[model samples]
Target: MLHKTELEYDANNHLFLDAYHDDAQPYLGLLIDIHGGGWFRGDKDKDADWATRLAQLGYEVLVPNYRLTPQVFYPEPLRDMDTLMTWIATSDFNQMPIGVVGSSAGGNMAVELAIRYGVPAVSLSGILDIDDWLTQHQAVEAAPGDLDRFNQQSSAAINQTGSNDAFYKWFVLNYFNQRTDELSAATPVHRISATTGPLFLANSLAEFVPTSGVLKLADALTSVQVPFVLNVLPGNRHAKGYLDDIFSQITAFLATYLIDQRPKPQLATE
Candidate 1:
């Protein structure tokens, strides 16, 4: 019943996206699932199973591969996402309601897109406040036995130095080209407005990503009176690491905004 097809969104760059849907039934809405790899490495295929599961629930899902850092920097990947959104807007599915869900770095972009496009979004362990995080946390090496605990609880691969802070900061610097001045501008917490769409944010209590950024984002969303839900589970698992436990709730939140509240298409009378 589920079908998947790959379509090119950026022909010039040879980038393609995988689309998933059920051929037997009308889809409820469009959902974009963005994969996370600290911005330098990751493929859409990594999220294929997750997209298939959402498609089985009556949603059309798209997973796109974006340009990564080193070869590209901060806004290039974001531009790739913008291009995908533009392609969708001009396609046959333009009339369908849409939403977005992402993990880690992808989650950061999802929140930005939700604000940019006014669509519901879900973020799993997103790095929401880069500027604040950089200021508050240092790239310290793991203490005695800390590496073992991090390895036990997290899905992230430890960098060569065995330091969580150093590993995370490395990716951030790569994405930004080591420029710290503009981080606040790219930070989602600093960009929230009254027009921003509803958001569902989930994070581990003490993951490689500091929980402080998530809380700061929540506070900003509250200050703007935007609707949002925050779920902090107990562990160090990041992003999709704990996704299975909260997936049903994520879909339900998306359904409330994208499907339940939208007007169903009516069949024409003969």
Candidate 2:
């Protein structure tokens, strides 16, 4: 919690982000931290610890916030996340070798960025496949007519154990608006390809998202021959910590992929 620093940003929706970096180095790579809060109710505070730790590990970190539901929905947040990524990339904000890390809602975005931008990333207990997630919610009443009915149904879903039902319900309704037709555009697994970057995925088999989803993502990555690893923790599906026990391996993985990745010079051409 010490040696913390924050940066100011205005996303034009009254949304802002707190940025931090390894000030010890004049120039450094970047790790963008996205906090998980059911996509509708979380902020950078959720991942500040992660940002701080990544900074200690010698990477500049950017933890951002996105405009959410009621005013906007699914694709909007995706665009917001992309805007931050693009800003960093073009600005070259003082470094190179950019990467992403997210948990829960944020985890989904991190994986999406990895797919979209082709950069190394990690997702902890992420809701990567949303259509599948809704199918598994068990409590969500599909397309509950109007917003009032939708809210009522989701209110019940909010109580489903380990489901994190409220967030799931809101994310869907806010985006698709009462339509259960399909979520192809929002699902990350369907978009994975050989060009996707290396990934480190971890999940706890408890509440919130399904462990099976994590395995499915891992399976897809393996099938494509993309370099990636999956770590399954005991039983805590909704767990997230960048400075906890599991982070040790995460650190090692990213250190190799993000920090150490640089072009090697060919033997001196005489």
Q: Which one wins on TM-score?
A: 1
TM-score of 2: 0.81
The parts of candidate 1 lying over 4 Å away from their true place are 138-163, 260-270
Model 2 residue runs over 4 Å out of place are 1-15, 25-28, 92-94, 136-175, 241-243, 266-268
C-alpha RMSD values across all candidates: 4.5, 5.6
What is the per-residue lDDT of model 1 for residues 164-268, given as tens digits with 9 covering 90 to 100? 676677678778988888888888887889988899999887676777767887898899998888999886777777878999899889988886447777999
Q: After superposition, how far is residue 239 of candidate 2 from its true place, in Å?
A: 3.4
Error of 1 at 261 (Å): 6.4
Candidate 2 residues 140-219, lDDT tens each?
A: 65332222322221122222345455655665555656566657667888889998888888876555457776788888
